[model samples]
Target: MPRWFNTAGPCRPDIHYMLPALRRLPDVQRLIAQEGYFVVHAPRQVGKTTALLSLAQELTAGGRYAAVLVSMEVGAAFPQDVGTAELAMLDDWRNAAEAQLPPELRPPPFPEAPEGNRIGSALAAWAKAEPRPLVVFLDEIDALRDETLVSVLRQLRSGYLNRPRSFPVSLALIGLRDVRDYKVVSGEEDRLGTASPFNIKVRSLTLRDFTAQEVAELYAQHTADTGQRFEPEALALAFELTQGQPWLVNALAKVAVEELVPDISKPVRRADIEHAKKLLIDRRETHLDSLAERLREPRVRRIMEPMLAGLALGDVPEDDLRFVQDLGLVRMAQGGGLGVANPIYREVIPRVLSSTAVASLPPQTSTPWRRADGRLDMARLMEAFLAFWRQHGQPLLGTAHYHEIAPHLVLMAFLHRVANGGGTLEREYAVGTGRMDLCLRYGPDTLAMELKVWRDGEKDPLEEGLAQLDGYLAGLGLDSGWLVIFDRRGGQPPISERTHASDAVTPAGRRVSVVRA
Candidate 1:
């Protein structure tokens, strides 16, 4: 059986194998034949290196070109010292070349250089001497220092015109970001334009996560080999939770096959997939850890805060939006808006970002608050939130998303504490929606709430609140609804003092209550 859960690097053919992106291969081949420099970027572990390596092998197998894959990732560990970094990179390249190439085709001893273009010159010399067309795959190209990166890219640029006979005919720079954004700085404080060094790049390709169908195909391979069938619903549930991220898809399957299923003859079920998701989340696996780390970055937060609040803005530039999208932070909704990419990301984002705050929340019974009838008591939850805001809201406002339509995070934290083990809260938020709808699924009942904060001195919010609550309650198939509106206006009276009014009845004949927090 093949091992499919690969977290370290490119998938090894002898261990874990994958379906080739045949549709992309023709384009890659065309670029190589045209002697073009190109880029392949994707979120980490989306199979960029694996695809490039497979493409390199295909090219070399044709006997038309000699292909080599070298990683510059190690060079990045030592920054500011270009000389030592270059030597380390060159040594790495030589070792990889020696390992991949056959004895008869191995090049002569690598050249020695004290400084100036050692790597570039050595590679150019080797390509010139080899009879076959040379193709090079530079993995993790972003790892090189500013000076080292500039030197390497400039060398490739200078050698581009002398392809097939004088220098490498095809080159690929693979990393997390696009080559165009790469900024290389020289020791003399001169900045080399990214476009100048990699000007020959004709195209950039990104390896996307698998679709639902593709995820099925991957798991079917294991079933074919072992006669262990995955229940149909298991695959669907996996897709729902993971959204077909390659790593999570594989990890979930590994857990199901190795841990959940007691015997090879038994079929994997939805329960198995659910168990796998919980195990992964509870363990806080490395992949999840790395993903959580990105949530704190200011750029990432700018895109995420709005989505969390269900009010995505449209003023950001295309590049910034694309960068976030490329990182798998958000995806385009069916109606042409953006939303969190998947359920796992949605769940992980809140827990990771507000871990500190969640920890500080007082225990459920410790506070002077308790939900009557074992439900998320909106009255008590909101009171606690208002008290928290009165003390910490201002200090946190700079970091808090006050500009958002609904501060679902703060409210969710309060409810999360109250409903810690007894129930689950499901949140639905999307970019450009301008509202957040939360459903607290408790035993034998459900509570539907629409969270919105008043801004700019709006006096009577009852009508707007009713309309929003109507939509939320209808979707949830509930009769009664709660619209918790934050009174951002100063000097607002307490909930007891403010009028508790009911708007027009919903279709189910249940009235929607508008409450001020």
Candidate 2:
């Protein structure tokens, strides 16, 4: 009888703590009312299926259409074989209709049709037989690739002229990507460069992540259901960490209330939310794991590599940028720049990238950095890193897939090892910044660091590095930090011979450790 936060699939109000699914995407109804065929796309697990299913039920209940939501995912199993894919998809469609629709609203049997035209033919038969106009939301449409994908799109286009009376009055192709992105993924970008097979689409709409206010409303549902309340700080932190990602919004709450602090009498606090985030990232739950797995993707690395190293994104193709954005790996700011979509991803990206380097680390590397007081001794940590870099940094660079950011990745891997079990390392970088900032948090010790590279035809960058580390330290409310300048010019000495730490003062007179390697 209790309602809980839903993460796995479409929210069922009977047992899930959720906002109105249609509320997040009110424009969907307007598009349908115009009798348009369109696409609905967003990153995975952000409630695309939930919103579409809720809309189908709402429209059917309004008595205007016999609406149903079915998936093309089952068909994706036969990506190259259009005949088998269509057969599986139609079979799925029939089963979905039987389960969701009332007997009066369900279509009669699907008509027998040959391989190529089966989906179109069955849709036509259903549209003609229904008492009211039919509306269909095809989920996971982009899951198809190659010829099967092209066939599906063209078939939908083939039936475009016949509407309401023969074909569904309105239809939506729902997935993680827009039509053009699908083309790019399937290696047909050049062919579909000018026009997509699904060109009849009126517009491509994406579901937005929940606003902070929406996050509060969703968490409040749990409070209303039980006596537990979320402290105001916990609510703000959850939104800050997740930026109102639906699954993250729910998953954070689920972990906090269900596992971290399960007592109904205890209110969820800011610390609880923070710990929940740590647990989520550490566990690499299915959703986060899938997103992390994309870091090495060719399209993904093209953008992420420079961003990770805090360098300019040089002449990246528009679709490639959009492809990563569509995957939800990163988000574009209102003023037009790209960054990792949320803090959680920012954490996951480098962690995933540094995983290989971490494995290559000697076990003795972490031990030397930890003090008896359970604190990560910053001095010892840096000393261990200098030794590790001298010994293993060269080979570790080869382990990184992102060549441009290999040094950055190697350093993060060293820090990850130092903070292996009891510490957290946070990173901040932006394109054009020319620096990557890191914050390592142990029991009661905090170490702030800034990294920069000295390339050919460039100045020493020590003074600039000091200035940047000053700003970083000021933000962390610390009096000092480390500035690592990797001298990557044409004729630098070996890492072991050149690597050494020296003391310097920032413009603000904050003492800084300048490590030039």
Candidate 3:
């Protein structure tokens, strides 16, 4: 049988082209060797389960430890019921052992105990029955919430002193975040804000995304297997776009080879990847949609809203920053500033944010924006957008829930409607930048746009916007662009009364279409 890229679940080496899942975290084995309990957390579908599964197999195959990877996700259903969660968890553990380990390595039946003590009791029984030291990888440990989450972590911490004689020699909590970010339902919001009970953990480590070279190596595996080579430029572009995000790296190639250019003798090109990226974003597969779902989360919005609008991230908690980083939504850039992890994600964020507003747009909204040759007519598009904004922008703003970036979202929705299928709408915004840059590419023409907001007590921003946009247009090597300044003051007039446009020249003498709304 032939192998292919695995996207939906844990990778099986026998069937999927992959790098060693455990290679990303070299400390796991050392920590386990020292009998330490630690955490392994990363965003969804980045090979957390695959790494644990591979590590378990490697450890158990060494004939020194009896290791198995199980999931706490089964306990997620009984968030408020400690007893039921423990029961479901233990039941699943047994079934998981049967499926993941050989008979000689499998534990004896779990011993019964009080509801609060069931998990500790079960692990004690398993450790006692096994001839070898046992290691347990509990994947999705953060999936449990409230009392159930507290109960499990407490049980694990309680069992820490027993070592190999009465408890697993070493344990790992695997999930999307550290135990600190695990939901314990502290107070008002259903978000994590408190510390964890699992203080016994030695370290909370994250699985880093693949490096640029690893991405090349992984893609080369597909080339070696199917004789369908990815061009060098395609590989580099893939790394650039995905920033070594494991799922996205594989997903882009999977789409390119399987859907775009399946011929074994042919090579995949950079254009294929660009097309695949658009497809992936458009399709909003389960993985990307899962990311989209987080856009509404308060913790996520606290960071993303400001970051998206290119304004200062004021007073955001470090926990919030770490949580967002853990969710793979943002990362520290080269200069120690925060940034969206990758180019594809940069595109994904605004598109997802603008989705509702896009739907709110009137029918045939793009008709006036296109020229006879199917090109995006810049003047017409801007004129149409100004007219549309005067008519319906305020109401459509309600469709976008992020108040800080509502105006940006509304405009993106209209542009998305213009560039949806045949073109690309790319965005570049970061914290403290005070503006969002947009590159709308349709047909052979590209439109460079800068978006700024006129908040209460702020300067008019016209001169500053033109200065900033001059540099932006210079970067794009364009002789002209558009600068849109949105008036978001408290007592601003109605859209129809205030929205207008005029022509201006930047410091570089670039022709800029200036729109004030």
- lDDT for position 90 in model 2: 89
Candidate 1 lDDT tens digits, 1-517: 5555455667775677366644434478788888888888778767877888777777777888888888988777665666677788888888887887665445556677656477677777778777787899999987665767777777778877877677778888988778755546522123343455678888987777888898898888888778888899999999998887888888899888888895889999998998788678767788889888877665666778777765556576566577678787788877787878888777777766555555555554554344556545645554665566555444343343334532456566666665565666677777656567778775666778877766666656556667778887877778887777766676766443553433456444567666565
Tens digit per residue, CA lDDT, model 3, 1-517: 7899889899998999989888889898999999999989999989989988999999889999999999999989998899999988888888989988999989887777988999999999999999899999999888888889888888898999888799999999999988777877743245544566787888988999999999999999988888888898999999999999999999999999999998888899999998999899889888999998898888889999999988889999888898899999999987788999899889888888888898888787237877788877787888888888999988988998899889999999878877864788889999999999999888889999999999899989999999999999889889989999999999878989899999999998998899988
The candidate scoring highest on lDDT is 3
Taking the tens digit of each residue's C-alpha lDDT, what string does model 2 give over 50-81? 88998899899999889999998997788678
Superposed Cα RMSD, model 1: 4.1
Worst 10 residues of 2 by lDDT: 184-193
TM-score to true structure, per model: 0.85, 0.97, 0.97
All models: lDDT?
0.71, 0.87, 0.89
Q: 47 in model 3: Cα distance from truth in Å?
A: 1.1
Q: Where's the lowest-lDDT run of ten residues in candidate 3? A: 186-195
**Can you tell me which runs of candidate 3 are displaced by over 4 Å?**
186-195
Model 3: clashing residue pairs?
A: none
